[model samples]
Target: MRRVADHLDIPELERRFRTCPDAVEARHVQVIWLLAQGHTVGATSEVTAFGTRWIEQLLERYNASGPDALANGRRRNGLKPSLLTAEVLEVVRLRLADPPPDGGLWSSRKVADVIAAHLGLERVLPQRGWEALKALGWSLQRPRPRNPKSATAEEAQAFKKLADAVAEEAAAHPGVAVEVFCTDEHRLGLKPVLRSVWAPKGQRPTALGHHRFLWLYVTAFVGPATGETVWYLTDTVSKPLFADLLDAFAKAIGAGPDKRVVLLLDNAGWHTLPNLVVPAGLRLVYLPPYSPELQPAETLWTLVDEPIVNTFVPNLDRLINTITERCTNLTTRQPEISSRTNFAWWPANRVPS
Candidate 1:
């Protein structure tokens, strides 16, 4: 006690040992406090659950630097200086856009090798390529799956114009209220859409599954303004099924003479109906070819599929039950649905019918 008393307050040390914010530092303090109470290094190690050599190192650091030394359990040497520069990294990024010299895509080792050759170095650590990417403001992201065909400039511009006009008209003609909703469908089975998960160090986690079974399809409609959704689960999707779904949707939303229900949908074969029975007071607004991005209802499929991901269903009945429960749960989460479906150009502040 007398030895450490000159440098550190005894009561202060006890208090810090009890309630220190940093777990690592608090552990070191506990070691010091036990030493102050006259325990040998070996005895302190047993009580503190630390190794004997670790205790000896702690004692050496404390004897040399006093209480301040105990605050940090380990000393951190400054990072090695970066050999890769902005211009070099930028070159790497641009060159990575095309196929690599040896392969289809650019990899960390290949990129590192390329950097070494350019800088006239004997070798560069392949691991540094990942670190350099982060430093250069690149992030690892799961790219959104999109179709190969792209929307042309004219199509996008036309959509913006159409959206603006719809907003204006809906606002101006509230009596002939135009209720715009987007609808889409998705298929589900026993297969899992596995995503990244937190796992133990150096151990990889896998979302394992068996053969596909009990397939089902879901068609849903979303109202961007009120976050209301109308959906149906069916065995298959076809023109007849679509017609039935559309009729059900019309009844669910109560489309009548007072308003026009503008239902936005994709250009699927089933969607292309020459004699499609669009119920009275309902209009089918077919989206541009190959543009799934335009349909707000496309977002609902993700929410609907959440229950089936990384999961197993033995039979069709069980899967249907699970999906229905999730659908019912989603209907209560109006705010979430609203945020996902809120199109920038949709009519603002109109009363939801």
Candidate 2:
């Protein structure tokens, strides 16, 4: 039998146990009250549904700190000071800007080491390190891959130049309706596109892969402002084929004397203006070399791959059919497309003057 100190009278303990609003606190108070009334620890455990060991611990707490200790301890804060103070968090943020001391990716354990060193402590728990990261408003994320050959300054200058050219063209032809669009080509083949998916613990999801060389080209033209999309499927790509596609796109959009369409493109060999034919009312603007990040149409490939990813297709016809269905479905989801492709700095659609 554990002894409870003379903290409160039996009547006061009964009043507290009855008046406690929280169920957990009330249960804890009832345990103390039962023990204070000369009940054995085993008797209190049977009555309160608390374990014998836990009841003994509760008696120790009440004896040490009285009624204040009888309340749910979890609800009480500031009992133990945290080492991750505002100053320590600021130091962590600055350290994160550079590669970690071990020259690898940052993890909870690595962050724990950083925190421990900053406070001059021997060590900190990885769980506490993760909590500190959440407190600092940080999350784990995979970084987008950047091309080594991409010129940042040139990409910025090209964007500004494109914006100015659109403004200038709109001013030059006051009566002409000007619309901006991005165009790109994606190649889908018989090769399986693998992706990660959730499964039961200790069991990995499997995807069937059949590698073949047969290919299909999907050329996409998208209006970032409205998310209106035009898709063309072909067996292959050539300068003549690209010219025919442009003409078809122009006719489909009714881009003629009254409407001018400025098409943004990458510097592919066949896309250059040397011998290739370009239709009237359709002007081509090239993005900076090696800068696919600036091309809004590049983002569409992920959405295009959704139907075929991790699924095996028997032949080129099946792959084409699956992708065609996916494309048709994507056309109806304009808002989703716009949210993915519309960059903050993209030029807005200009109404005719």
Candidate 3:
């Protein structure tokens, strides 16, 4: 095998190995060149970290067809040739999105077999199925489990127009500095169970889900333009409690005789109660009933849950302490909240000075 490289000696082969663009091919060239330099195949295998049999095959190919045989074959960039073309790949992507026709999931073998048949080829490796799907821009994703409903086209259009109009009015108004704030409420219990996390290879994580998993309500008002936020946590979430939170939020936003807040809220039962207290300089605006899709503050719940997500707190006091700490931290993260909640139809990113 070493003598077969008589024409292309170790010096020239070493130059070719250095000049080769691809690392894998360069390795193949180096293996044959080393054998030419009087190194045994086993030593070459140990040095190259490639198996002995693969080294032998490299030598055999070089002996049969010279240096060109050591280069990449029909496989392009380590990918198989079966699913290489675009026309065959599009069909595979379409089929891959749906389950197998016989009422089960699509396995790599099934996909590879189908694609091979489509291309009029004998067979394709199961691993190539993954490459084909990836080439078509598909990914292994776990979509939101509950398939929540979205606003209808008409509803979405109407909301966009109305929101745009409100923004325009706020921008054009004279003297009075009006700011839009999206408000929402979330209930957290004393359960520390999360859906998933990074854990040791095959262990299901455990968390403290104490018997008292009752509700602890958190009400928040977020000024998307100015990155201003106010939150209140309590055991009760009625109109009266909402009133107290609104009063505190009023002071947090520097609500005075001149400056005002245009607050947006969902149509919850407590929110619509008669004589519900809306603080001075803060006007409450109700979004359409059952339409949470329009409210920006709903997005803040995922962020506020970060601190206490996978922990075991003893009682309501500890839970409240953790929740309060997270709330205080969130006030400083107004920019993130704004970016997450502020929609394209919402007002400009400016708060009254």
Query: Per-residue alpha-carbon lDDT of model 2 for 63-156, expressed as tens digits?
Result: 9998888777677464433677888788888888998888998888988888899888899998767877888899989887777777586555
Candidates arranged by TM-score, highest first:
2, 3, 1
**Whole-model lDDT per candidate:** 0.76, 0.86, 0.77
Tens digits of per-residue lDDT for model 3 on 257-306?
66666778877888875789778877677775567767888888888887
Runs of candidate 2 with Cα error greater than 4 angstroms are: 1-3, 7-30, 39-53, 64-71, 76-81, 153-158, 196-205, 321-344
Can you write out model 1's per-residue Cα lDDT over 38-148, one digit (the tens) per residue?
788878888989998888777777778888888763434345335777778887878777788976656677778778877888888887776666666777788876666
Reference-based lDDT, residue 225, model 3: 74
Q: Which model is ahead, 1 or 3, in terms of lDDT?
A: 3
Show where candidate 1 strays beyond 4 Å.
1-82, 141-143, 150-158, 161-174, 190-213, 345-353
Cα RMSD (angstroms) for every candidate in the order listed: 8.6, 3.7, 5.6
Backbone clashes under 3 angstroms, per model: 0, 0, 0
Q: Which 10 consecutive positions of candidate 3 have the poorest summed lDDT?
A: 144-153
Q: Which residue segments of model 3 deviate by more than 4 Å?
A: 1-82, 94-99, 145-149, 153-158, 165-173, 193-206, 251-257, 273-280, 286-294, 333-340, 343-345, 349-353
Query: What's the CA error at residue 289 for candidate 1, in Å?
Result: 2.6
Clashing pairs in 3: none
